[model samples]
Target: MSDTATVYRQRASARPRIEAEPPIRHVAVVGGGTAGWMTALLLAHSGYGPRLQVTVLESPQVGIIGVGEGSTSWLRGFFEELGIEESEWMPACHATYKSGIRFDGWSTRPGHESYFHAFASMLDNLTMTQFVDHVHRRLDGEDVHAHPDRYFLATRLAHACKAPRPRHEFPFDVWYGYHFDSVLLGAFLQRKAVERGIRHLPRHVVAVDRNERGDIASLQLEGGETLAADFFVDCTGFAGLLIDKTLQTPYVSYADALFNDAAVAMPTPLDGPIMSQTISTALRHGWAWTIPLTRRHGNGYVYSTAFCTPEQAETELRTQLGLLDADVPAKHLRMRTGRVEQHWHRNCLAVGLAQGFIEPLEATALMLVQRTASLFVDALEKGDLGAAAQATFNTAVNAQFDGTRDYIVAHYKTNTRTDTDYWRANAANTRLSEPLTRLLKTWLARRPIVGGIQQGTFGQGYPVMSWYSLLAGMGLFPDDGELRAPAAHEPPHSLAAIDNLIQRSALNFPDHRELLGAIPPRPREESLQVYFW
Candidate 1:
């Protein structure tokens, strides 16, 4: 043999064999809601061994805080991944397509000033920086009265109250989310998960037991049965049954940045045309989210208790919806704006409200749970994930939470509304993270661009275009005279092309109502009687 071959053979013979770590054969998820059920289903669908088992321990007495009624488009991919058909679930949950969110009366200008944060844009071919610069220049010149929504095809669809037909092959991508009944959604997911062989137990966890190594060993159910698993997932909402109360994870609060802590939600009978999007109308001391579903409307007033009372908020919501003097029952929700510093501990992981909560400003509750469970699934796929993987998961999840918190804070910090003490206090709040601070300073000097202040890879929560919309919507950008001049480089297409794109798509796409009518209607379950988050 050659010298190298002889050396390799000798070294291999001298080395000792190492054993692989044991795989996680069983996973026990505590709590049940959209988050717990989604995690269980995902794990069951991950193609683990037949011996691998997943069980969901849901309480029979706990109620669901049906506040996650709105969702981001990310859930669409999640559904597609799990082999779920839109046709079946949409009607089952009384769902509707959400093209985007429209913020009405958000600007300081007098009269009806509003803007849209659209999901789909026709400018997909252009870099985000290019789009931002073009819109900034246009706003400075002839389009001084322009809104960023003018550049998004989805905005046109939403405004026209139209939807793209599923059968038609479109050149551009169609982006959308859903507005659904959260409680109904949970029921649907629970049925699906149970059908797929995941054990669904309606039992409360009364006690938690841990191994000597500090990993979760088992859970004691209310009926005196002990359940053991190789790993545990905490989806116990604010209770944090496993990750927080048992593991003793540290937490970081966003209260200093995001002031809203209380919400009062009420549903109104469907009295008007169902819109194709979520409408967030700004209030004097808070904001009201109007989510239109096939059955009824989900409305809520999110405000800071520091500035407004719960009774005052409920009155404002009723008045805004023209239900003044109407004796309507309202549901109240209390929240703490914070997240655990570490989501994954020795052998336990927290998902959804158990991990953290930053309010529903961006409808991130469901999406965050999806992402957290997905990350844990990925770690499992890498054979054995020990301390290194735990550390990495915590770091990534923290960044996403903190990044989303900063984005929500920006809405308040950049607002020009000083009409109320709440607005004034929010605008003057001095607890901005350094990253957002740098970004806002840069935006003042010029327009925002992709990757400017966002954490994680592209396509994470709140992209650059979103920042531009919020800033321009609030009139926080520098004055036209001081704004940076457009880049000398020309755009690839003329403005007329964008207009043509919107016009052609609008003509081909069906009206939103027309599409909803086509979904072979199922008998609606008596509308869910519940309050909002």
Candidate 2:
């Protein structure tokens, strides 16, 4: 070679080479559903290339709890990262846009019985400071309208039955999620993962085998075949096959904090314009969720079996839906509300219902699954699944689950309803996590909640705006008689101005139904292959 060419070759040889093989060559995800498929897909997309093999061993006999589901904005990021288009999966899954949740009858306080918990948006930055200021003013006896619904653009869009998808000309981005058929979503994800070269085994996992280190060594199939991998993912729903049954991990229940334990779900015909919001109405026993899909409305009554029987819940739900005499069947689900002591144990990581479930009060099920799968991928890539890395991952995941529990528990604890024994019990019960207690203390003391959360080790699941919305929406404030006028120098916080801004901003989005209609149907060939998984 020439002198210049020889020098360039030497310099190139000195550079570090990328590792072609990942530390964990193969990962076996046991169970199939949204969690299983999602875990598989995320692993396949984790930049490990063909070196990291992913296998999903799903039981054909185990039916998925295909309830109507809503997700947080995390799911939008999930799809975007996977290069899946809204038009592609949304249409196939019978999905619709969700701006946020509309809570009704959770409180009996006048003018505060209903509130909207909106997903945070870029536009919130424009008004959050003023909103927080008004909240402080209202707490200090000023006659300010600090209701969160009036302050958020998502609430406005939801009220107007508008999609969160802003027009191309709209400068700011609006973050939102979706309501979809869970079964379809799982299938869609499975297809995507399979197309990306992930292996799928439609076989029953009859037994789990452990090595000398007590790590999951292999899974025994029904016909005596064995499937082994370097790592294992437990997506076995609430059964927690590997994490709970196999690993013998300890479970910490949240029964003292959250009372509702059972849910009865049934579908209702779409009766009106599709709304871009989930409706959570407090019922006699617990609460009812109304999730609107493109084809139907998914309605469920989540209550405590200790308070109401399955038949009673179904009857109440039927009464609510005006289907008391209708032949529509309701699917009842028993929920275990809590988390494992450790999410990542040994060579196994748990995802989905197997990880633990808080009541679906906030539609956080799928969001948690997404977080777990993504976090596990990052942990594995960074530390090659070492003990220290596992400990750190467990801490983060456990914190998230506990934090979510605290938030959901607050929903019940702060409820202003006393009509039912259940509601009364929730309000009277004092079993609260330290973080929630401190945060509540901060709010009641008229201190800055944001500061309290920032200062302490608060659960990092929900944002500060969410806490503000929940507490303020429930009218958890001092009595009006205790109020006094603002100081002369205090600048007025105009409710009309906020309203005007939100109203005008909402106009930038299209009607919810129209937006759903705009998404063209998936190709016939793809639709035909949807169930191939």
Candidate 3:
């Protein structure tokens, strides 16, 4: 070989090589609310605090959508991962422990309508199918006056108006979430994120600038100031400031599958003692959720615009609530049920409402934000997210969204409430996704098998048991001996055993009000402004 070629090869071999791109250093999060602040804090906590500069651009003029006051039990793990102490923020946000949700008046059968989707996972070592079979036998007897929920500890506690005592650590048997003021929750998370050195920008973004490669370059502020970063997170809510308007990402709408499009949210004085769980009462056009916070009840009527006008919905809500007139103030919100075609595109990622939203039926908004943030952190830990990483992230995120949508759709589709066109249309055989349609068919022959719902591309959605709660609550159980043929040597749990478990839990758990009153009060300025959880 020539001397010049030999020298070049030696030098190339001598130099160190970089296996992957450098980790994201500067992240600019646009918008400020629960999603924005939550994203900022989570990113900051993911070993990016001092090195990775996280900036949140929040506008003082934009109002937050504070109706998502309820949450699922998944929030506990998120809070724990961030080392967020419950004592520090719970009271500040007017949060109360939520055991689960209770559904009332959704079924066609008289005198046996209400059922609970309790937080309790399972009883003894029995599988959900076995427990369900045990309950089915009792439900079939003409002389037996049994309710299946009585067997579960969480349900018993909720039915008795009791709440579990607060614990100081993680990994508990009885899972729980919370009902809190969403606006206040944003404020509380903002304080935590800012203290951790996340830059807070109280400026409105007037324009988005893109580089030659069509990636987000910077955000133009109202005063012509430019804020730039290496990565961008769009938490701008429904506006989709960076993801849609700038990148022109396609969106897949769920309008055909889901019907509710608007919500009339209001807060009212506590009519009675605070309960431990959210109450989802089935209404004519849709459902009404009553979330109990420490100070008041956050109530909303989530109804379809096709079935009723805003004025008509308000009137019906008032009638159901027994309100004489507009003594209580109410705000209306329009929602789009869909997701961006790609959650992570180019250099930008959309979180929360900016990504898309389903209704608050299962209180999944915050849960999705938490999941998406964590997933991004995991991806970043491996290497800088290139095309391949972005594809994986998008696939995971889309599966989660689709799974959650199917679960929510199940609530509407399984209902026997045919009192209105809204309910009738939902109950009618509409176009269900291939997976959900198959599962529904399998469930008709027998109880839902754990493997059927839990197996998928994303095995991280709802637990297999949750489907049982929802289906049972909607009165969709199979006939007496049709659930599953008993295993040859399988010993079954008796009703007496189940009743004993319920009695023990009821005796051990404290009343909901007792636990509420025990919490130390935090001092703050009182406000007359109505708030929703």
Per-residue lDDT over 145-167 for candidate 1, one digit per residue giving the tens place of the 0 to 100 score: 33566666677778887763333
In model 2, which runs have C-alpha deviations exceeding 4 angstroms?
A: 1-20, 520-533
Listed per model in order, the count of residue pairs whose N, CA or C atoms clash below 3 Å is: 0, 0, 1
Candidate 1 local distance difference test against the native: 0.74
lDDT of 2 by residue, 1-533 (tens): 11111010001011122365677989999998999999898888776766789999999889998899999877876776666778889989999999999999988888899999988776777677777787787776777777888888999889888988877677656668899999999999999988999999999999899999899999999888999998999999999999999999999999988888999999998967899999999999999999999999999999999898999999999999999999998899999899998888898889999989998888999889988888887876664677788888899898889888988888888888888899999999899988888888878888777755544466356666788888888887778887677777876677778888888888898888988887642222221100000
The deviation in Å at residue 2 for candidate 1 is 51
The worst-scoring run of ten residues by lDDT in candidate 1 lies at 4-13
Candidate 2: 10-residue stretch with minimal lDDT: 4-13
- Order the numbered candidates by TM-score, best leading: 2, 1, 3
Better of 2 and 3 by lDDT: 2
Worst 10 residues of 3 by lDDT: 4-13
Task: Give the candidates in order of lDDT, highest first.
Answer: 2, 3, 1
Each model's TM-score?
Answer: 0.87, 0.93, 0.87
The TM-score measured for candidate 1 stands at: 0.87
lDDT of 3 by residue, 1-533 (tens): 11111110001011122354448779999998999999998787764346768999998778898863988876765665565656777888988888888888877654349887776432322334345565444333322323446546667777777774423231224556788999999999999988888999999988899999999999999988999899999998998989999999999998899999999988877756668888999898999999988888898999999999998888888888888465888889899999998999999989999999988888999989988987998788677688999999999999899889988888888888877899999999477777778777766665434556545622236654567667666666544343444444654656676677557645766677777666543212211111100
Off by over 4 Å in 3: 1-22, 110-112, 121-130, 135-148, 166-172, 457-460, 478-492, 520-533
Best by lDDT: 2
